[model samples]
Target: MARFLLRRLVTSVVVLFGLGVVTFLMTQVLPGDPARAAAGRNATAEQVAAAASRLGLDRPLWDQFAAYFGRLFQGDLGTSVVTRRPVLDDIAQALPSSVELVLAAMLINVAIAVPLGVYAAHRRGRFADVAARVIVLLGAAVPVFWLGLVLQLVFADRLGMLPLTGQLGFGREVPEITGMTSVDALLSGDLPAFGDAVSHLVLPALTLAAAFIAVVARTVRSSMITVLDSDYVTLARATGASERRVVIRHGLRNALVPVSTIIGMQLGWMLGSTVLVESVFGRTGIGAYAVTAVLQNDLYAVIGTVLVIGVVFVLVNIVVDLVQLWLNPRLRQPARGAAPAPAASLAPGAAAEAGPAVKEGAVS
Candidate 1:
């Protein structure tokens, strides 16, 4: 297990390094000059040249990339050409809102998808299954921005029940705990502020979660169906296990392996999808910042954001891999006679061997 973890960590680092190189190269190849963009249309040739020199844009692309990577290693993300602010600071400020939005969306996705999937699997040929399929199709077909606009119109304009824009109430100043307005409000014991934040978050979160929920539901339902037909499930049923118990215990637990993989991949999809959702909802987040950086040709900010997102993707996948290994005994244990146990395995054979068994039972 320790070796497995070390291998995964090393792989994650390599993947992140590759991502950084790709991002840096892509930004370098982009058409517009960052110095010119920073200087604006009214600036003279000498001004643009001076700005380029100041930003090291006048340096060779390879040298610039090397310098960028060097600074990155030291935790410096450089300054935004447009905002003139440290890219790291900009990301730090913007990341919390994006994280809050994505977290809420994922929560909504899991809450809806898991139950619907289980139900659809259990009622495979029934109307419930058909309805779930239809919902999934519609969710995937509709664009998030359109959904956001429609939701904003109905809930905010027509119903007049929720705020149309922003993260908080007009008069109340919500604390910025952890950078997530909703969490901060709750932490501050400001229930009213929390409620307001939740209200505003509802439309955007639902809009973002719709497609993810569809994907998760379908994946889980398929996995569940497969698991239900397995021998253990049949044996459970033969032993007079209750229908619900057989389905939830023997079936769902087995189905989690595939479902969890999909859930992990969905984190990346959710982050990518947030760009449009944030724009439509007028939320100030990393997505919005990324958009602004691209439009202004702020290469540093763009690269920094891409690097941050790539790191997030890699970390999430690593966590998922570890969780999967923990949940599935087959992943943590070697096949019989496949290889001799590592030294770490022998030190506490009795205790260490029990780890997989305990994890399996816990997950199951």
Candidate 2:
């Protein structure tokens, strides 16, 4: 376990380093002088030069990168040229909404996918399996923006149900200590606030989760098909174990590694889709924050926010890796460490000395 964690920690660090370099290069390649833009057209060359110097923008590229990274370690994302507020502060305010959205969407995905996947795998090559595949294809093919618009049209415009825009409405205030309105409402014992929050959340959550549902279901179905054919699964059935027990305990348990990998990868998809989903619903979150930052040409804000996203992306995958390791310890352990004969002790010459009892037991 320690070795596995250490390995993942190193990998995460390397990934973050690469992300920082890429983000820095992207900022460098953008058109126009960032300092001049920040200072406005009326500002003299002297003012622009001063602004650039203050921002470390006038420094050598390597020195600038070093300085930016050094500040990042101390949790200073630098002041946004556009907002004149620390980018970290802005992210702190907006991050919760994105977190809340993604977390809720994942729950929705799991709730729908697990059962559907299991049923489809069990009924492989039949109607249910084909339907599951079709669902997956549609989910993958459909654009998130288009889906969000259609959802808004059908649910908000046509039916006049569900909130069309914003995370909350008039006179519904919950202490956003946790940054999630629903949780805040629950914490404050405001039932109506919670209800309103859910009503607002339903459409966006469904739209975001729709893509993941099919992906997760298809992955699960595929994993189950492979696992169900394994020797232990067949052995479980031969021993008169209940179908449910055999399926869950043996088949699904061993499939955790692949399932978790898919789930972790889906986190990236969820983050990318948030830009459209939040924009469509007019939600104040990191995705919307990112868009605003870009529009204003806020260099520091964009870099800071994207770096934060990269950190989150790395961390979530690390968590998934840990979960997979726990689900299957053999993943970390040496292959030969797993023994079918736990009770039988072998002598130095056990193979040559083995007789009827050992042979019969092994055969059985």
Per-candidate TM vs. native?
Answer: 0.89, 0.90
Q: List the residue pairs that clash in candidate 1.
A: none
lDDT of 1 by residue, 37-148 (tens): 7677689999999988977888898899888788889989878877888999999999999989998999999999999999999999999999998998899799888888
Query: For each predicted model, how many residue pairs clash, with residues at least 3 apart or on different chains?
Result: 0, 0
Q: How close is candidate 2 to the true structure, as a TM-score?
A: 0.90
- Maximum-lDDT candidate: 1
How does candidate 2 score on lDDT?
0.81
- Each model's lDDT: 0.83, 0.81
List model 2 lDDT by residue over 1-364, tens digit each.
Answer: 7887898899999998898788778768977677886787689999999989888898898999899778878989778877778999999988888888988898888888877888899899999789878886787689888998998899899998988988888767888779988888889999999999988998888889988888888888889998888655654565566888766766677655688888887886687678889999999999999999888878778888888888988998999888887776557665585665632332222233334544576789
In candidate 2, which residue pairs clash?
none
Per-residue lDDT value at 305 in model 2: 84
